[model samples]
Every structure is written in C-alpha cells, then in structure tokens.
Target chain A: MGLPPKRGDLILYSVLAVIFLASCAASGLLLFTARGGSDLVLEAVLDGKVVESVDMKSLKDESTIEIRAGGGINVLAAGPGGVKMISADCRGGDCLRMPAIDSNGDVIVCLPHRLIVRVRSRGPAKASPIDSMTY
Target chain B: MNEESSRGTMIRGPRKIGMIAVLSIVGVIGIFLIDTMDGARTVTRDGVAMNTVVSVTLVSAKPKPQLNAILDEIFALIGELDKKFSMWNEDSPLSEINRNAGISPSAADGDLYSVLETARRVAMLTDGAYDPTIGSVTRIWRDGTGEGRLPSSEDIASALPLVGCEGLKLTSGGEAYLERRGANIDLGGIAKGYALWSIRRLLREKGVGSALVNMGGDILAVGDGDGDRPWRIGIQSPSKDRGTPLCAVRAANTSIVTAGVYERRWEMEGREWTHIYDPSTGFPIEGDLLSATVISADPAEGDALSTAFMVIGPARSLDLLRILPGVDAIFVLDSDERGMEVLATPGVRDSLEMFDDEYRLTFVDVY
Candidate 1:
C-alpha cells in the first residue's frame, strides 16, 4: 500500500492548488477584459495625405463628447463624454495621446489636425441608453 | 538532480517536504506547457514561400510580430507573378513572345507558362467559353489614344480568324504558337485571381491562424477568423460608393472573385466599352450582368470562373451552372428596361444569408 501522507503534506498541496488556480483565473480575467479594447487609428486630413491622427480605440465609449487642442488645430464631438487630443506636428506624440476631457466648455487646440476640439456636457436629467433607444 | 525521494517520509523535516512539493509543481507546469504548445501556432508552405501565424488565440495572448511579415511575403509572391504574366508589362516573357508572333516561344518560367497552362485548362472546361487568344480581336475594337468605335465588319472578320482557342499550339518545351500571325494571349481575366491564389498560399504557410486578403474586391479568407467567429467580409453593392457595403458573409478559408464591367472600361466614338470581350464576334458582350462573383478554393479558379460567367452572360451562365457539378455564382444586373438584373446560381442562393431583389438563375445561351 502507498504510504499515507501527513496532515502537513495535505495542507501544503491544498495551498499550492489554491495559488495555482487563483493565478490562472486572475490572468484569464485580465485577458478577457483587455480583449474588448480596440486599436484603431483615426486620421483627419484636409488633403489626400494624413494631416493628423489620433489613436483612441481603447477609450471607454462616451455619451457626451470631449475635445482638446493647443494651437491651430482642433477636434469636436458631442454625446456621452466624448474625448479628443491636444497639440501636435510630430512634436511630442501629444496630439496623438493628448488627454481625456470630460467637462463642457473646455476647448482643445491642435496645430496639426487643423482642428478645434469642442465639448458639450449634458445634465443628470438626460435619459440613459435604455430610455433613448426605446423612445 | 539528486534523488531526494530515496528518504522515507520525513516527520517535520521541512526541507525534505519542500523539495517534494516543488518538484510536483514543476512537473505539473511542464505537463501544461507540453499539452498546449501544439495549439499555440502553425506554419504552412505556399508555392515556393512559407507563411507563419501564431495561433489566433495567441494573437491576444502574445505579440503578433510576424503577421505583417506574412502579408508582405504574400504581396511579394503576387508581384512576382505579375511581372511574369502581365500583358501590360512589355518586359515579360509572354510580351516578348507576343512581340515575336509566328515563332514558337522558348520554354520559360514566370507568367508565360502560367498563362499557357491556364488558357489550355479554361478552354477545355468552358468549351472555349474563355480563351486567351482573343488579343487581336480585342484590339480591333480597343480605343488606345482615341475614343473606342465599332470596327468595320471587314476588320472584325480579319481579327476573328486569329482568335480561337483551338487555333493555338502549345509544345511540351513551354512553347506557344499561333496558327496565324496575329493571335496573342491575354490573361487579364485570370491573372489577378492567380495572384490572389499565390498570396493565399503565402498566408497558409505563415501559420496565420486566419487571414483575409483583399485586392480591390477579389478576396480570399485563409482560415476562419482568429477565434470561433467566421470572418465577416462585405461584398460591395454595385454602383455605390467604395465605403458602402451592400452585404456581408462569413468566410472560412474560401476565395471570392468578382468580375464587373465598371472596374475598368473605356469610351470611344461616344460609346462605352469594356475589356471583357466575346471571342466569337470580338466585341464587348452586352448582358444582364453588371458583375459576377464566384467562390472557390483558390483565387485563380475563382477568377476564371467569374470571367466565364461574365462571358456567358445571364442565360448561358445559368446553363453553365447546371453543367457545373458543385461551383456557384452571383450575378448582378440592371433591374429595369434600362437593362439591370441580379442573378445567382441556385447553389449560391442556398448559401445566401440575405438579399433584396427579384433574382433568378435560368439556363440559356445568349452568347
């Protein structure tokens, strides 16, 4: 007959299995969440060639728009918290990633996109997605 | 490497127990890796090239460093094919042969051999429904520097004598000869599809778990989309803007080739003409179909089949459909007395997820 394991041995195996399974589960969850992120490059240009581009596929979907910029260029959008970028020309990769602007009345300028970012905010009285779709 | 298991089960010997636990963990982890590696990535050989893609699952789990590399190789193979086969490429071997008409060509590689082989095969299957030797006839009605005008009956008659598939002789040494001085081979109908086929092979070799290669509308899906979802590719509705897709279908390692009059055509003598010509009369065929699409295992076959549909027109296309064993087709035509109709093979209808319009497939020989 195989030798019986001590209580300590049993406890050790139980702990290891818990650790192994937890790590696996955590990693899988992170992967599933990350996969939903989109990676798309949106380029706005006046000519056939690209004037400026922003990579915003990963940001959360917003109902209101956000816009940002530094100089001659600007971006504009509306709805649930839209996002835009600020400043560029291959200067700092800034016009590329810029930052998230959530409030209304904030203006963003980019010398590169030839764009002006305009944001419009909605009050809490606004309907949610379910109500809007039904109406 | 020491055999720690030699010792009897030790009581409170912390180091000994720790060793057993560590070894067990390592062994189990090893088992997991060995079990999963085969499903991780796959590579394939396409014609003379190789393509590799990590498992579709890995595309998310790991970096896809070689995906673009695989696509680049596919493009390279197609470019090579184009250099060899394009009638437009004056430097091609086939062009050289065309320039030296009435002489047997020396055996050679590149586009010349491919063109000859494809022409011979298409002739037998389509019963000369598709022929590469219609070059002279096509030129009589072609508008190069000026508007395209109808060739006189005499000119057409002169060109017709040089245009039959039965009129050319292909020797085993890769030589093609025209029974008459004026005949030439034009693989325009089939070259793009062949290029797509080569590209498909390149993708297959790269272990690309799944891929979709689109050259203006000739598309091939190398495998199922990365995961369980089929790759949903849209077919452009005719006469619409490029961004507007009429419909979509899921592809699982299949090719779709579409031939249309609108893709490339010319106007001459205040009249419009297309490159798809009828060898019997040597002129652009008037038909119900504005376009025809075919599904096949490879691009070249799909391309040639799509051309056959275009050549056969609506009625003959339907008849050809009945003659074909398992192939399918989709035909779009003008819907009014204005000369528009949409037609598709019965087999194609079975695979159709959705379509809008009164479409039918009938067997007739309009050509």
Candidate 2:
C-alpha cells in the first residue's frame, strides 16, 4: 500500500500538467496560423536551371517570352492572373496543357525539353524545405 | 515507537529528493524534444548554373548564414561542373573530347570520367537506345532547329554512321576516345543527372541530413520534408490546356527524372521534330509516348533511363523496365481521343494519384 500524496506534490504535478497543456495549445496555434504570407513569385526554369523570376505584383502587362534550350523552345506568357506556357515546339504540348499557376507551390513542367515554371511564396511560406521537385 | 518513526522519516527524505530530481530532468528533456521537433526550419537557395535554375531546399537546425554558405559552395560546384561538361563551351572538357574525336584518347577528369562511365554503362544496358555518341546527330538537329529547317536525308545519312555508341571507347584509367573520325559524344542527356547525384553526395558529406537538388526536371531527394511528410512530386500533363497535374507521387530519398518529347521541338516541312534521336535511324524518335518519367535511387540511372525509354517508346520501354531492378517508370503516351494514356509500373502506380479525371490510367505488371 502507498502513502497518501502530500499537498506539495499535488501542486507540483498540477503545475507540470498545466505547462504541458499550454505548450500543446501554443504549438497548435503556431501550426494552424503559420501559412499566412501570400506574396507569390513566378520562376521559369529551363532544364533544371532557373532562367527568370517575375514578381506577380509587377506583372502589369501580359508578356510572352521565348526560352530555347538545345532544340526545344517554350513560349511563356505572364499576365495579371498567372503565368503559363502559351506554346512550345515540343510534340507533347505538355507545358501548354498545364494550368496557369498563381498560387505558391504550383508548378508547370515540360519534361522533354526540361522546362519548369513554378509559383513560390516570396517569404518562408512553410516550415519544410523542398525535399523533391517533379519536372 | 514515535522516536523510531521519526528516524525512518529522516532516512526517506534524501530518497524522495532524488526521485523528484529525476522527474524534473525527464520533464525538461520532454520539453526540449517538443521544441526542437516543432521548430525545424526550411532554408532555400537558388542560382543559375548549367543553363538552368538550380535550387536546393534543406531542413536544418543551423543558422541561415551557415546554410547559405553551404548552398554557395554547392552552387559553385555546379558552376564548375557546367564549365567542365558543357558542350557549347569550346573550352569544356567535353568539347575537347569532341574536338579530339578519332585522334587519341583524351585524359578525362574524375567528374568527366565518372559521367562518361555511367553513360557508357547505360548505353550498353539499353542496347544503345540511350547513346551518348549521338552528338553528331544532335548537332544536326540543333542546327536545323536554329535554321528552322529539317536536316536533309543526305545530312542525316552522313551522321548516321557517327551515331553509334560502339565508336566511343573508355578505359578504366579515365581516358575516353572516339574510334571513328566523325563520331562525336554528347553528355547532354546524362550530364544534369550526374551533377545532381554529385550535389546530393556533397550535401550528405557536409552533414546535411535532408535536401532536394532539382536541376531542371532531374530531381534527387534526400529526406522527408518538414513535418515528417514525404515529398510530393507532380508529373506534368501531356495534354493540351490541362493545367494541374496528370498525377503526383509521394517520395523520399529517391531520384525522379522525366524525358518528354514536348520540351524541345521544331516544325520542319509540316512535321514536328524533337531533340531525342534514334541512333539507328539518326532521326528523332517518333512514337505515341509523349514523355517518360523514371524513378530510381540513382539519379544518373533515372536520367539515362528516361531518355532511353523515350527512344524505345512505351511498349519496349516497359519491357525493359520490367527486367531492370531498382527502377520504376511512368510513360505518358499520346492517345487518339485527345487525352493521354498513363502507363506505370506497379511500384510507381501505387504512389501515383490522378488529379485529372479525363485522362486514362493503366497499371502494368512487368514482374
């Protein structure tokens, strides 16, 4: 049989329980509210190399730019809504098939010619670093 | 009896104090673990090298300055690799090899030799479907694309004899030679993959536990993303105006590479030509496959196999992939109904999630 707990022991246990709960609440709040910043930057990468980065805020005019790598060429259009591949000489037309990317972490990839266009948040948008990217 | 109980209480006092101390230490460690696990930060760095934007994202406990310095070193290494491997640069080792074609075996640097050895091994494995010796043919297509004209049959025929990988010989001592006078070697198909593998090794050596090295579309993933989640990779759609992924796969510590016919293409005489050449025909491979994406532990294997699969088309490539161990693939083939047929190996099929309902997905069992 065990002896009855003392008042001092009860107070210490209660203090630790409260602290644990408080930390849990704090971490929960931090995790939920972490993805707040929304500033987006569009990046154009050809064959794994970044060629151009355009701020979404500065895209006042729709512009078409041609990116040529080896024998492949991709024509990209940047506008107020988002950036997209307008046309490409590659036979698959995969880049042209990709939707316009406006939000962070959305990407359009042309695998044959190794072109990638992606939208990324200007600031530290999320906690995890990039672990992998699909072309 | 009262005096005896008092003496016993005195003895228990120090034992009680020791128990309390141990509990406090446990509590503190618990708190520390929670804080460190929740506080993991992701640092990202990007730079232009190898004619593409190279980006590295790492999850680290280190300060930003230290992380940035490591990234700077990686970028510098990539730049040096680009200088060494780029065929366009006249001073590059690869260009020198091309310039010295048929004359003598050029002594290759460690990096060059490693890439060439991998390329040669892959060439042999794929039965020359993925030849690095197609430089002569690639040059013709590059010049043709620049001029917006197709290479004539005469030109293609002349380059055909020069397109065989058998013409290039590499010694175990890091020397490379082209056996034929007109034969040229291009590492374009496999160079980026080799660079990514090297970068991943460098990061590992630098004590980085997790990272992603994406050179264009050739990707090497090291560890889990933030929050212990597997990395999500989206496969590009081959259809028209279908923005959103055809599919996505979750991966960690793997390399993903895609070779498609959609990126580099030129129109000549009302026909479209891509950069990938068939060594046997000395022309761009024509088939239903729009792109081939391969996943493997080795980045160079993923890179070389992606190109080889693109050349061999879907059916033959799937056959090849079935017999090959440690690799899986997804082939996006052009369909008659304006959509695509997504064929994947069982391993790849398990992780793939189809985002678009319009496309067809077929799972193949090659085992």
The numbered model that scores best in DockQ is 2
The TM-scores, one per candidate, come to: 0.61, 0.74
lDDT of 1 by residue, B1-367 (tens): 2355444434335665688678767765655554344243322211111111101111222233465356446656665676777665699876776666676554547456666777668766776767877777766665432342467888888888887777767777767766667677777777777776666665556555565555546776766664545655555566653323444455667877777786546566787777688777777877667887776675776777777778887667667667665566667777567354455555544445433343343423322
User: Candidate 1: DockQ?
Assistant: 0.05
- The local distance difference test score of model 1 is 0.56
User: Evaluated with lDDT, which candidate comes out highest?
Assistant: 2
Error of 1 at A3 (Å): 31
Which regions in candidate 2 have their CA more than 4 angstroms from the true location? A1-36, A41-80, A83-101, A106-119, A122-133, B1-39, B240-243, B337-339
The candidate 1 chain A region of ten consecutive residues with least summed lDDT is A126-135
Task: Please write out the lDDT profile of model 2 over residues B182-217, one tens digit for every residue.
Answer: 787888889889988888888888888777777776
Candidate 1 residue spans exceeding 4 A from truth: A1-135, B1-63, B138-157, B204-209, B335-341, B355-367
